[model samples]
Target: MTTIDVKSRFEAKLLRPAKPGNDTSWAFVVLPRDASEQLPRRGRTTVEGTINGHHFQATLEPDGQLSHWLQVSGELLEAAGTAVGGMVTLELAPVKKEPEPDIPPDFQEALAATPEARKVWNTTTTIARVDWIHWITSAKQLKTRAKRIVDACDMLASGKKQVCCFDQSGYYSKAFRAPEAESF
Candidate 1:
């Protein structure tokens, strides 16, 4: 339950896609490095915070540049009546409970159509489910996403409980990798 409070302006930045051929419309707000360093974890952490007095619950994720940030959804910006460059008062505390992501309807239907996959999905922990959802949704193209959904269902039906060969925490993901220093 560590909490940190800071008053700063919201910084507008585009989150470049980690994978090539992915859409580049992802935008986010940069969290102050000073404040971000106070959190308990360097990776994604469930955070309950307020922006301009509007309460929000979100995950603070690493920005792949040794920094952390929160995604600024259009709803949040509208609710706060603030845009990208507006000054905001922020207060954040780590939430003890992990929040589950909403599964897309198509994905849900795919699981329903596959009983074996549904059984495996039901047995997985909340965090595991979240990771699966994140990986599937990370695909930028509709075709890719649909393919991922089918592949996920097939994998689960085959008794696999997690998304193999993927960095679930995103630490080693292309966007979050440590920069290579120039050789002497």
Candidate 2:
């Protein structure tokens, strides 16, 4: 598959916790607006990349301010032997094919228990399913995640085909503030 390769070094930083109970320790590297614009997609772009020599696959997401950024999970940081506030070199290339996201066990069970939801889930497109799974799994607290699962089942059972008010392409959460707003 053809890919667009970009190599750059960036300083990693932890975004402020989305909510009080959330883990703000998640690290990220911001891509310049020009570089982001050259990417294949505007919202979520599937990618295979290297971070400080550790190979990884991830979705590059927009930061809501027309810039793109990659979320550096704790696992990726550990594999790369890096830490928050550290500088890391990244080599990214857009992947033409993206494998399906694995559904969380709890979510899979919830869907199994609600056949109607599962039916609706089956009818949704892959991107829609991805958004739903991302929404449910992105929760930081167990309680929140559980609630999302329940909510998802309820929504799907009610024939809701897509997650409401979610910007799948934007940053980690819908609550993320733009850099300018964050400076205050």
Model 2 lDDT per residue over 37-154, tens place: 6666656667787777778889876677666777777788888898766677776766766667788899999999999999999998777787898778767799999999999999
lDDT score for candidate 1 against the true structure: 0.69
Each prediction's Cα lDDT score?
0.69, 0.72
Which candidate gets the maximum lDDT versus the true structure?
2
Q: lDDT by residue for model 1 over 82-148, one digit each (tens)?
A: 7644566677767667887688999999999999999999998777787788778777789999999
- TM-score on alpha carbons, each prediction: 0.66, 0.62
Could you say which candidate leads in TM-score? 1
Candidate 1, superposed: residue stretches over 4 Å from native = 1-27, 33-45, 60-62, 73-82, 169-171, 175-184
- Model 2 alpha-carbon miss at residue 106, Å: 1.7
